[model samples]
Target: MNISHLENQTFNPSTFLLTGFLGLEYAHRWISLPFCFIYMTVILGNCTILHVIRTDSSLHEPMYYFLAMLALTDLGLCLTTLPTVLGIFWFDAREIPFSACFTQLFFIHSLSLVESSVLLSMAFDRFVAICNPLRYGSILTTQRIVTMALAFAFRSFSLIVPLPLLLRRFHYCRTNVLSHSYCLHLEIMKLACSDIIVNHIYGLTVVAFTVGIDSLLIFLSYVFILKTVLSIASREERLKAFNTCVSHICAVLLFYVPMIGLSLIHRFGERAPHIVHILMSYVYLLAPPLMNPVVYSIKTKQIRQRILKKLCAVKLIQT
Candidate 1:
């Protein structure tokens, strides 16, 4: 627990073995089929969202711009986990170098916070648009958006930088086998032989203050948005303001529901089956990235129109 404890030597594994499901090894190849589809869809969907926002002049507003940031975070998560996730299934490649595993853990944690922050940002954008439509343009300018993006990115990066260093000091005397297909701070730290009280305390503090608090803020933002929408003089105005938030509400649910589920399972479901743990982890990581783009494209008329037009052109060329 002491920084001076760095002087103590400990056994560090050359690599850690990542695992799929506990008893599902026999079905890994079969399971790979759906996961392969999911990964492909996540990449294509998020990429399309980003491309449409970037090329289409109509999407230059703060809302779509924040959507692009969400897409980037999704892509970042996919890039971080894709290799080992697919590798574990198709090639049976479970071995990850210790340093590589730590790096993976870093990105996985950092991008998660970035995703949460992006959701809050989108909610705030909606709040401003609904409460003060006239001043929305003046408030959320391009410079301000860039500044917000950097501020969150810096926050996520700075908070996560200590994890790898802190973890390096821990001794793993037992099996370095991880519970899931990817390296996670929780799973990796489970194998530590030395006292991990400090790691646990620090990690929980980060989660509570960062992601947990941000989720609360997102909710409060929507509460204010709803109040503003309700006070509107016109029925059409209320509906219009409320409808604009449907996509963001869906995005928030997609990201947070499985996240909360995984957390709950870990906290109270200690006796839960091993596969339960693995399945929940997969859902938390894969579902949001895959679903967010789909939900947004379906709910946001501008995005949906662009995506549909692109698809029609592609279909016509193929025919």
Candidate 2:
């Protein structure tokens, strides 16, 4: 197995194999049924959210704007994950090109951070609406939302840009079998034959600065929001003020719980079953996008009413 001849040139493989759920090869097709359904639901649900938000003038506010951003990010996640996931489940097409693999990994990681950023923005939005109701409009104008969106996207890209390049410098000569259907930075990095201390450091740094800091900010924003809500004397007022935050709290939990679960499993579940890893990764990728729209639509009165109105209009037209 001496790749001595590769020393003259380089030893980068042309493709990396993506692994789906293991020991369930007999049920891969059955597994694909839920995945297909999840993909379709994500598309329909997020598209419905985007359409509802765009077409309704009454819904044009900072809250819905951030929700729209969330929808877009969810769609981005869906697109990035769908190809490799379905490829593995349905077609057994797991041999992703090195470049394509890196690109997929980048978007998967980047969009998660963007989603984190959006959630943080939404938290702040809640804090403003609850804690500073009078000046909310001035603080979170459309212009500022756009600016924040741009800044978040750029920050995610900048923080993640080094990953592929760092990975490129290493020569991967080990088994290219990856644990999940999609390319993950750590999973791929593990295949390299060289020292990966730097990669590990940089990866940890990115997670800390992006997801760590953002989640902390979101928690603090909610603390302030809770404090403000408590100051309101009337029980009715307290409930009403707290109600505005319910959808956001659900969204945050949806996005972060699976994420934190998967992270913990990766760090501490080394002796755990491989299927546990695959299942955790699946939840990490699929749950948030598939569930966010449902949560928001059910929780947010305006979005629910708008969706119902649109559905009724369609029904009337069809009739």
Candidate 3:
């Protein structure tokens, strides 16, 4: 198409393009390898965690229930972007239909919000376990766990439903080129020809109320946990109490640190190097799913032993 014809194109285009990385076109094949590895790790790791939890009757507790929920969320988050991202890197399939783009955007952000909420629930799990040992079972009963899981799903669905709908009402006259490898609300909204003040406002408001508040509550929960740990008279008891939370603490930091960094870079580092944004985005999306299972496996004795036993049984059968 001629330049003039392209410029005069209608606002309601059928497809949108995703530019994975600006200057890395030559290295798309190589880059996709690592991403493929990461995706495999994420899927296998979370699935293993879920499988182990399901098979172990001793793990039929509130903490493991929350953990199963977290694993499911991680699976959702990774799968939401995996298809389109790998397609761009491997097959040059960057043109996404308008409706599919909105659907991907919805799942990605909603799963992220769900993950943040799951982390907060895990923090509360730790807090109750550490702060009220005797009442832990009474507080986080099976019924309560089911209720919380349903609530989390409902809240995420409610908040994320309006985002794509809001964007659908906008007119897109500019080139519908997205910066990242996948569809996101802010990135997609940036292509709109019409005003997006409300979009921007609502996006920020959602992040603040959901992720922002979740982060604050997680930190506060840790603060109380530390206080409770310090009150114990014996040094070994204090250490033991803190040790139980070490895996969760690592998971929290792995998740939120990159997430917050990416948010800050997006808002303030307009002039930052492109690679910085790409790396931060990858870390934010990939780290938790890949690391959570490893962390829990190494730190939680029950899971570790069960995994070892299962491995041995498989090895024996093969031999």
Per-candidate RMSD, Å: 5.3, 4.0, 2.8
Q: lDDT values of the candidates?
A: 0.88, 0.89, 0.86
Q: Which ten residues in a row have the lowest lDDT in candidate 3?
A: 1-10
Q: In model 2, what is the error at residue 209, expressed in angstroms? A: 1.0
Model 2 off-target regions past 4 Å? 1-12
Give the per-residue Cα lDDT of candidate 1 at 149. 98
Best by lDDT: 2
- Listed in order, each prediction's TM-score against the native is 0.94, 0.95, 0.94
Question: On a 0 to 100 scale, what is the lDDT of residue 148 in model 2?
Answer: 97
Pairs with backbone N, CA or C atoms under 3 Å apart (clashes), candidate 3: none
Native-vs-model 1 lDDT?
A: 0.88
Model 1 worst lDDT run, 10 consecutive residues: 1-10
lDDT comparison, 2 vs 3, better candidate: 2
Best by TM-score: 2
Q: How much RMSD separates candidate 2 from the native structure? A: 4.0
Which residue segments of model 1 deviate by more than 4 Å?
Answer: 1-12, 316-319
For 202-270, candidate 2 gives per-residue lDDT tens digits of: 999999999999999999998898888888999999998888899889889989999998888877888
Model 1 Cα lDDT, one tens digit per residue, 1-319: 2212211332237777777764667898999999999999999999999999998898899999999999999999998999999898888897888889999999999999999999999988998888888999999999999999999999999999899888898888776777788888877787888898888898999999899999999989988888887888999988878889998998899889998898788768879887788889999999999999999998999999999988898999999
